[model samples]
Target: MNKLIEREKITFHKVKPDPSSLEFGKYFTDYMFVMDYEEGMGWYHPRIAPYAPLTLDPSASVFHYGQAVFEGLKAYRTEDGRVLLFRPDQNIKRLNRSCERMSMPPLDEVLVLEALTQLVELEKDWVPKEKGTSLYIRPFVIATEPSLGVKASKSYTFMIVLSPVGSYYGDDQLKPVRIYVEDEYVRAVNGGVGNAKTSGNYAASLQAQRKANDLGYDQVLWLDAIEKKYVEEVGSMNIFFVINGEAVTPALSGSILSGITRASAIELIRSWGIPVREERISIDEIYTASARGELTEVFGTGTAAVVTPVGELNIHGKTVIVGDGQIGGISKKLYESITDIQLGKVKGPVNWTVEV
Candidate 1:
């Protein structure tokens, strides 16, 4: 029987890179998935083809109006040769939600799921079996219509590309990182497209990120736009602080992203009898907790970095060290548990991992 998604394999596969020395998003796989959408025609022509460059018109809306959204998820290769995807449905649904926020047409969840499975299945060999490596799948949508007007584009292109990669923090670079608290530049406001996984949100953050780098910090910890005091996110990931045996994370305000890994960590921490609270958190409060010796651990959760511990914080001119500049117990446990669940060593929540 013919599958719903069309497939076209490449004539010759490129020489695979060394899996042990893979760079993040540096190397791409042999195949890619693509689909198109029009105002009246909806989405059609779902197909998988050989990896190639895209040709777009000069006045594409994505280049002008910036109507682009993307989602990131990984495919893990089990020790027994099976492949698994962690919370892919959540990423797909979040992609649609991002599309809605960006004035783009929604994607069919069923079609996308099918296409992802088929594409990953075909490129199973590209899934690295390294200890801390996996296949990074990037599904993105861009406005392709060549229009100069500042309006929503009539046509859009959705594409999924696969990259076999190592850790986002580099090879064997899973230790704690220094974060600089940013207050001068803001990432997003409440009414802005902050909650959406759009490209502009990231582009707007580059300035602060660069500032943090110049200040000798690994990443920037963005505060709320309005007050510039409340904690928002640390670099591109959601942040968590352990205070007096409680896991405190910034609430899912309109500006903060609802990270799937953050949610899973919260649930797992709660299951371990640790209280997890999602509310508006302030950097000042964190500093106070640290001064009082209540701050236990600080970490970040996201798709790329997974779970990253923060060892030191640069708050204005004061320097704050987190738990003796080392990975905390909670951070270690969450990282191990999540990776185990992803690799099929232990079962997680129902429907968490979709085997491809």
Candidate 2:
């Protein structure tokens, strides 16, 4: 443990449930975990208390500077009635990486794990029983020092909140979504905080997503900021394509978040006897492959939706349908395997799931 938590701070709130109309991230659990840090004084007084509003001064650095980072992961209830977290260590490591980029202090990984485990234990009933539903755990850090200077804040707060989220899509799995390739607006850039899970990265993408939706597209597929031809990612998920019997994705390239699900999928593909490559993939290559009938599938991978297939991609006034306008062979198998492992139907590599 980082430091023993103050048991007195623990509190719970009871509420009625409405299953008919559950929206993602709308409701939260009764209790949350919090820890504070100051300039010379180190982190102190870890507490698990009732979820409530945070009061910050009008001139807080975060208000003006936007120094905030967050991570999202899920805890599932196995068929045998046990709670488990999938690859939690990876999330903490990613959190530390984001902290470094945002100039926020990093907590001990062991401490974070312990704190999160305790939080889940306190709110075990909140973990949904439905197969496709689970407790969405969000751990975030924000600068809290009261100053208007354009610099990192000296004081900070780390908190964890839980949300019971169902499938991001409705009743049936989503139809293959149409994505718009935007060359006018960019999401991230090289030598920037693109690789970090910072709030600004997502806030920057919202406007483009709104524009795409207005244009009858499901989401925006952002391109490289410099050349605007290299494919980066789709919405918040990592993008993948199957071409010429191979699975290909754009390399990390210092400008994209390396998703945990993305890394897992690549390893799973390798085990399935498919070659996976991470290299620069230009939009021209995608168009060329589709035109030559070599493009088989396209999909996006993330924790929220797990895996979603993309049927149509619109690039610069040209619309291309992938593989007869339906999900491809590899896409179906990958989805089944990954979902099976998450729900405990199939065995996976060691350390993939941690018992709750």
Best by lDDT: 1
Cα-based lDDT at residue 141, candidate 1: 98
Candidate 2 overall lDDT versus native: 0.88
Q: Model 1: which residue pairs collide?
A: none
RMSD (Å) per prediction: 1.0, 1.5
TM-score of 1: 0.99
Q: Model 1 scores what on Cα lDDT?
A: 0.93
What is the Cα-based lDDT of residue 87 in candidate 1? 94
User: Per-residue error at 211 for model 2, in Å?
Assistant: 0.7
Overlapping backbone residue pairs in candidate 2 total 0
Error of 1 at 49 (Å): 0.6
Q: Which pairs of residues have clashing backbones in candidate 2?
A: none
